[model samples]
Target: MSSLFDPAQIGDIAVANRIVMAPLTRNRAIAGNVAGPLTVEYYRQRASAGLIIAEASQISPLAQGYLDTPGIHTPEQVAGWRQVTDAVHAEGGKIVLQLWHVGRISHSSLLPDGAAPVSSSSRRSEAKTFTRDGFLPVSAPRALRDDELPGLIDDYRRAARNAIAAGFDGVEVHAANTYLLEQFLRDSVNDRSGPYGGSIANRARLLLEVMQAIVAEIGGGRTGIRLSPLTTFGGTTPLDSDPQALYGYVVEQLAPLGLAFLHVIEGETGGTRNPPAAKPFDYEALHRSFPGAWMVNNGYSRALAMETVAEGKADLVAFGRPFISTPDLVYRLSHDAPLNELRADKLYGGGAEGYTDYPTLAA
Candidate 1:
């Protein structure tokens, strides 16, 4: 029987416990996408998690979708992240960087030279993205040219290298939640007729290539990938035919790569969908499709997480909002302490007010 506070080994890193701090976007980075001092303090405070997956970080300038999100593509960005990783490690924590590309879910306010966002097809997502001003409507992105894919692949490789340079223990590719990789994987948005589209294998090529590039830069044991099989957010609309086959095939292909782990988001995060009704495709079946460690997240109570792990349905469970309000979530869970409520208004683009203000048990 595995407890949330019990130690576990994930890939090349030895975790302090089974509790993982899921990657969360705080929107605290400064200009030029450089992580600020506040960012360092925030992660340092939550370093007690067995493994800390840093916020969704852009792999390239074009990958920017929301204002103030950090990036790992620049030297300054790398140095900024080094400060964060150093602080986390000093607290005896292991952290992984999550590389992100938002694709059509981006707004012009966060784009390079005011260029439209890029995606597999020229389609506009009905999703709204946060900007410096406020939440704005996302624009239709330009279709990525065939000649530009190799460069995009290079972007992921460089981002992985940057993560290593930034003192991170590993990296997690963000292929979920209607981001760039999800945009490519979903058939409703990806209507390209080229080698990178049309068939399921072709649609999955870009994500596979990106994973390979990251693994090439960093060993497979140091690389992880996050995916959302039943995700429909950010203009991600999977064909109703059989998502099981598409995602099962993806896991099968990824199984041979021996990735560090597979992080899956079961369903909607900010919606009113019932958990029982929105239960994602059989996660255990999907876990079997992949030969690596499997982690499941989204609206999981402490008891539910414990039950899931006890049943061997998930090797590990990730907590998102609970971690935000409880910096010492593992300790609190261990002792059955009450968790502080997270203020919805202070989630994104806020300063250190709600970011690092959460009190620890010892404090």
Candidate 2:
């Protein structure tokens, strides 16, 4: 049986266990979107996790959606990430940076000179994003000109380089969560008539291009991508045609890349709005589509996670809220200890109150 504590390999990186720390965004970075000492301590405390996927970090100034979120496109940001990577490594832990580009989900208040967010098409997302003031409505983003697609791809490539320079073990492309990449992938948001719109293949072009650029820069084994097939956010409505065909085609295209791994966010992030109870999608069909390590997240308990791995349904399991309140989650799971509950009030935009205050089990 594959145990949760057993060592596993996700591409080139050798993870000590299967208890991955799923990326959780805590708006606690410095004013310039730089990782600070507090961020360092937060990751170091949870080094026991099999692998840690750092919070979503913007790849450019225009990618900023939430206030105080970290970035990787600047020298100061790289230096700040170095502090975090060094701290985690010192504790014998492995960490990966999640490169993000929030396209239409961004607000003008978060952009430089208060410019509108950019996307594949000029459409306004009906979603609200976090800002310095509070959660505010998103605005229509400027469409990326046909000549500018290459530049956006270059931005992702440069961000991958910066992540490596910051001493990260690898980089996971934030193609999920209705962000920039997802914006382009979804048909509802991408109504352009160019090569990047209409058919599923065209919609998937940007993600594949970005992946190719990152692979060219750091090889396929050092790159990973996250996807949320069933999520509906940021004006991302499900295609009435056929979702299985759309997502299956995506997985088939990505399978041959031989990338690090594919992380899937099963459903909603948290228990915010109750997701409609529908029959679960055919994961076995989708899992076979990607010929690489697979990590599953969302409302997963230890028992369920272990079962999924033992049954060969998933290679690894990620925990989001559990890690938020339990810094020593892996140890607790290994010993069958009770976990601490997370306080929702301090989840986002807070200092270190409930962030790094989770206590570890004494020896």
Candidate 3:
């Protein structure tokens, strides 16, 4: 019987186990959005994960949404990440970088020269974003002109190439949460009328185009994507009355690409997988829609992960907060050892206090 500890393969990457470290934004990058030595130590300590999807990294200067979040655009950032990948690979661990564009989810303070954030429409998210100064209200984003989308796609393409140059095993496109891609996918925010809006096909065009470009730059087997269908994080509510139809179509469209894997956050992003009070969407239906390797995230326990894999519900499971405090998460899960509680106070923007100082079983 297949177990979480059993070996699994996603595309060309071979993992020792099915415990994936979900892309978590630690907000610890140094000035210029560069991953420094501390970032290397943080990931290296957690290299026991079958696969580590590095935090949401901006694809361009305009993509940044938070202070100290890393970027893949500049040469310095690429070199900085090269150290991270090298450390992970040295420990026989696989790592992938997540390409991100915050869109309207960003504050003006985080934007280039205090420029307004950009999105599918001119909507200003009511959600607050973390800036160097502190948490601030998100600014209204300028509607991206139809002509400018190609430039945005190019940014993703360039970032994919940069990930390869940085020695990353692959790249996961961040389409989840309320980022640029989600802003375009949901009708609640997308109010444009053109090839990039209106119909479901139009709304999904940018994501597909970006994926196609990335696949063109790197092979499809080396690329992946993350999607959150029912998440309300960052104030992203479902605008479509039938989210099943919306995400079903999206997953169906993604199936043909033959990418590495599709990572889905089955519940509220960064929240419980099965919230008792909420009427959850039939995530199983969407999981069945994608023919590729499916990775389910959100509030997964060791027993639940093993059960999901054994029952053939998902091929892999991703853990987020647990990884923050347990660097050797796979070992702890495999041995049924107790886990260290994450310091909620130090979840973001800290040096070594709660970052790499989290003791493993060895300590």
Candidate 4:
């Protein structure tokens, strides 16, 4: 039977355990989308994790959708992240960067020169986003032309290369949480009539293309992707008759890619595992769809994580909010220590109060 402390290997990276510290957005980057000392200390404090998936960082300037989210496309950004990677490596921990591009989940205040957010179709999402002032309404996005997709693909490829240059162990494509990739994935939101839309294969085209381009730069062994099958996080409804068939086909297409692991958020993003009256889809069926190591996430406690892994339901378990208040979460769980309470007020766009001042067991 496998435990959370058991050793495992996801692609080329060898992890010390199966407890993964999931990517979390802290909105603490410095000017020019560069990570700084606060970011370094935050990750370094939690280096006990089996693997750390760093927060979502933009792949290009046009990819910015939040005030202080970090990026991997600039020389200064790379240098800033190099410090973070060095700190994590010094503590003998493995880390991966989650590359992100928020599509319609942005306000003009978050864009360059007040450019409108872009997505697969010219529809407005009923989602709100964080800005310098506060949470603001997301604008209706303009649909991307067929020719414009190639540039976005190149951005992902370059970001993967930059991750390597910045000394990260690997990179994970942020294809979940109703971001740019998921905006194109859900049929209800994407009404484009090109090769990039209309069917499961067509809607999944950009995601697969981006994966192929990144794999070309960094081998498939060092690359991975995150997927949310039934999460209507940003008010995205799947109008497709069968979401099971759609995601199953997507997973089948990804099987042969030989990427690292597929991170799946089982239920609603950042919410309960069993959402009441939600659309029903077989989790076991989705787990069996991908032939690679499957990572399970969303609303998991230490007991549940251990039980799921022991039952062979998943190869890894990722924790989100708990890690924010407990720096040594792995140790706390394994040794049955008490966890610190989370201060939700200081979660985003702050200095180091709730960011890095959390006490560990050592304190």
Report, for every candidate in turn, its global Cα lDDT versus the true structure: 0.87, 0.87, 0.90, 0.89
Task: Report backbone clashes per prediction.
Answer: 0, 0, 0, 0
Off by over 4 Å in 4: 234-241
Question: What TM-score does each of the candidates earn?
Answer: 0.96, 0.96, 0.97, 0.97
The sequence of per-residue lDDT tens digits that candidate 2 reaches over residues 23-93 is 99999998689999889999999999999999999999988898899999999999999999999999999
Model 1, range 279-344, lDDT digits (tens) per residue?
356766888788788988888888988888888788888999999988999889888889988988
> How many residue pairs of model 4 clash at the backbone?
0
Give per-residue CA lDDT, model 3, range 149-239, as digits (tens).
9999999999999999999999999998979998899888889999989988999999999999998999888899999877778454554
Query: Which runs in model 2 stand beyond 4 Å of their true positions?
Result: 234-241, 271-280
Off by over 4 Å in 3: 234-239, 274-280
Give lDDT for model 2.
0.87
Which residue window of length 10 is worst by lDDT in model 3? 234-243
Residue range 1-363, candidate 4, lDDT tens digits: 888899999999999999999999999999998999999999999988999999999998878888899999999999999999999999999999999999888888778788888998888888888888888878778888899999999999999999999999999999988889988888878888879989889999999999999988999889989998778784644434566787887888888889899999987898767666467878788677677778999989888999999999999999999999999999999998889999999999889999899998988
